[model samples]
Target: MIRSSRLLNILLVSVLLPLAGLSQAAGWPRQVVTDNGTITLKSAPKRIVSTSVTLTGSLLAIDAPVIASGAGVPNSRFTDSQGFFSQWGAVAKQKHVQRLYIGEANAEMVAAQAPDLIVVSATGHDSALRLVNQLSSIAPVIVVNYDDKSWQQVVTLLGQATGHEDQAQTIIYQFDQRVTALKPALKLPPQPVSAFVWNGGGKEVNLWTADSAQGKLLQQLGFTLAPTPTQLATSHSMGQRKDIIQLSGEKMSEGLSGKSWLMFVADEDTVNQVNSDRFLQQTPAVKQGHVYPLGNDNFRLDYYSATHTLAILEKRFVH
Candidate 1:
């Protein structure tokens, strides 16, 4: 009887040992170092908070659920108004997105949500970093440098941090396939000198060079960049503020005589004002209907923006 009991115990141990190993394999380590900083994760974080709209969008794209999102549009209803997050369902159905709009994030509010991890974009605001530092006191904070990282890199890093690398890679592969399929369909005009205009309080226009993502997109579509006074002057950053000769209506018409124009406006009033301006009306692009208005509000150089920008370009310019 004793020998029989020992045999049964041995069998139970043999069966349970492999199950323990499997459980350990499934549960990844709690801490990971990202490009921005070292994140100390506590267990597999089920609840996550994202500060940037791009990060939020990227997470959703990878099938990762975010408990809270900071910036984008006010409500899910208005998200589609810009056509960026239009198909992301409702705010209520978006897992645990607390209806919180913080142009600048509040650390106290983040703490209140009690997220297992916090993700933020490194951009125009330094407040996000401060919030991350503060939140780190309560939980792990992972800062993603959105400006420098490519879309694939961002998605991969986020997947690694969230333990969803395979899932993220699958989504990225699908998106790449779609982009590849759509590239051949675009017919770009040869030597088409395109000018990108960004309208704000002041009627500002920016000339995209080879380095700019928008410029690269245009290049892929076979459009050439228009040479402006700044382009003629000393070479500077793609989107840098430079001292360029702002031509009046008469001069602008003559200056942009031969080239096609691609204009981007924030609001309808600004678009109307630019259209009504005599100088802008004289430009070749305006006369020839080459003006391309970027209607999406989520226009940035980040991963999400790049993909959406490509889709918009394909739809409007390609077709």
Candidate 2:
């Protein structure tokens, strides 16, 4: 009798929390501004076609039924990766979403999926503008660029666009609450923490600033940017703006010797390789056991990825 009562209470809370959240969202026929223009969604989308990996992952995180995804590539876990992309591949598979396309956006393929809403993002896709024009003729399209926005902001936009606004706001509220609670527990060191990714070149490393997607998360944790000065003036590789800076060999050695490190490399072998590299031999993080891996395959973080990142930080860094 006692165990059954406990289970029932747990289920009730789970069901009621979402109901309570939904009550706070505005009524149906919602409108959200998109890159294309003002988009008004008359009702919740039943079928959504996600044209980018980031959007696919974001949509799935909020319980949006993404009917198709652009994850048919060789590098994708959906191909055979067994959750190489932890955020979406399994969710996409569990939802039985179709693999619509890989490297290029296919309007016909996406159309055949019979989607009511098509989501395209400017990340990782070459022809966003052309695809938007093609899909607009068939159905409503929202062009989301997840690069510059905070994860909370991105999820809020996604929720509004997909009719999960209440849930989106709830996630942000809960996350901010958690952060507020966790702030008093961080045991930061004297020097700053620098996060980086190696290009697999001899000694080249790309450093992240406060504005970078991952760097934004780090900033919330009260860690100062290692190299200091959040943004610099310069346009360079991948046109990544000024937030990501590159260094090689002796230059990298000088910048990160005193700071702890966060490595966004894909796996343990690569982590070992980066630690052993001659250029990184003097890194303070490698010496003091402060070097940490975000995830082996989690090179680029999206909404779900950032959530996982925050959870891991809370567990590892807190007393």
Candidate 3:
């Protein structure tokens, strides 16, 4: 399919531009009860530092005043080592947000920003406990566990932590409305679509399940995840058993089967890369020509990315 990015870019600007006022909804002396424990803010933080890149999308979506934002761990998705995902680059640049340390959250580098509040996830590439303990010396730290929560919950937590819960709700509501509006034009194949991301430069493929960025959005739109071949699921899950699964291209065709496929990539070039793989080329998606590359800033998705995902589906299937 051809790229139609201008449609969604215009949609995002029109919907999110007026949210600046929502960030000003201050709830002073806010006490957030997180998985680690209760951390209380002295006041609504004017300057915020987010140590988790996943949380950065939520923080920015709510219009919180973040001075610095950290990047995600390497290979976590489309995120990079710079502690910034290109998906949110526009907002980060507009706010003049300092790109903080990526990799594991570094206490010393985060302290340099001199932020009033620091936010992170309990489980991720970076240890939230470590950040809470180390960064607490500099400012208040709020840690949230996202293992069992939906993306909306994560955004709501950030909203409460930064006194922007209303803005968070507003954003989530807008997304819901858009999903409903797009429903009329959307269609799905008989079987679930296996949505995954392929890295063209590195030749790696990762399955996006219910717990992942793509899975969450597509499942919400009444689509099911592709059935993981019994053997692949066992091999991929191992002992821990997480929602998202990763596999090499050779094994990918064995695990994925359906009439349609939604592939996520950094650009169109990755599509060509996937096509060149003999094993990947054998899948039913390839045979039927149902493969579609997810457009726009979707390689790594978060709160803001969900809106773009909807836009992509609406344009692709909605006549």
The RMSD of every model to the true structure, in order and in angstroms, is 11.9, 5.3, 7.4
lDDT digits (tens) for residues 1-319 of candidate 3 = 1246887786786667535445444557757887768887878889898887767877888899998877664444465445466577678878888877666778888889888998877765544566577788899888866544567778877888888777787877777777777776686655578887775443556676677656777877888787788777755333342545667757777766656778775456666766667877777777777777776466546676777777777777766
Candidate 2 local lDDT, 89-132, one digit each (tens): 67767888777666677888988988889888755443355778
| TM-score order of candidates, top first | 3, 2, 1
Candidate 1 local lDDT, 1-319, one digit each (tens): 9999999997875455323322222455645567565665546668888776557767776666677777655443225432234334244254646734547777777778888888877653322766666777867778876554455667777877787666666655655566777778866543566544443433444444454445555555556666655434343323332312334334455444335555532335555665677557665666665555555433444345556566766877676
In Å, residue 179's CA in model 1 sits off its true spot by 1.7
Indicate the worst ten consecutive residues by lDDT in candidate 3: 235-244
Which sections of candidate 1 miss by over 4 Å?
1-27, 30-35, 40-42, 72-93, 125-127, 190-197, 205-258, 261-273, 301-311
Rank the models by lDDT, top first: 3, 2, 1
Off by over 4 Å in 3: 1-28, 72-83, 126-129, 146-149, 200-202, 234-243
lDDT of 2: 0.68
> Ten-residue segment with the worst summed lDDT in candidate 1?
17-26
Please state the error at residue 256 of candidate 1 in Å.
9.5
> Which ranges in model 2 have alpha carbons more than 4 Å from their true place?
1-25, 75-84, 125-127, 201-204, 228-237, 240-243, 246-258, 266-268, 287-289
Error of 1 at 191 (Å): 4.1
TM-score of each: 0.67, 0.79, 0.80
| Candidate topping TM-score | 3
* Candidate 1: pairs in clash: 249-279
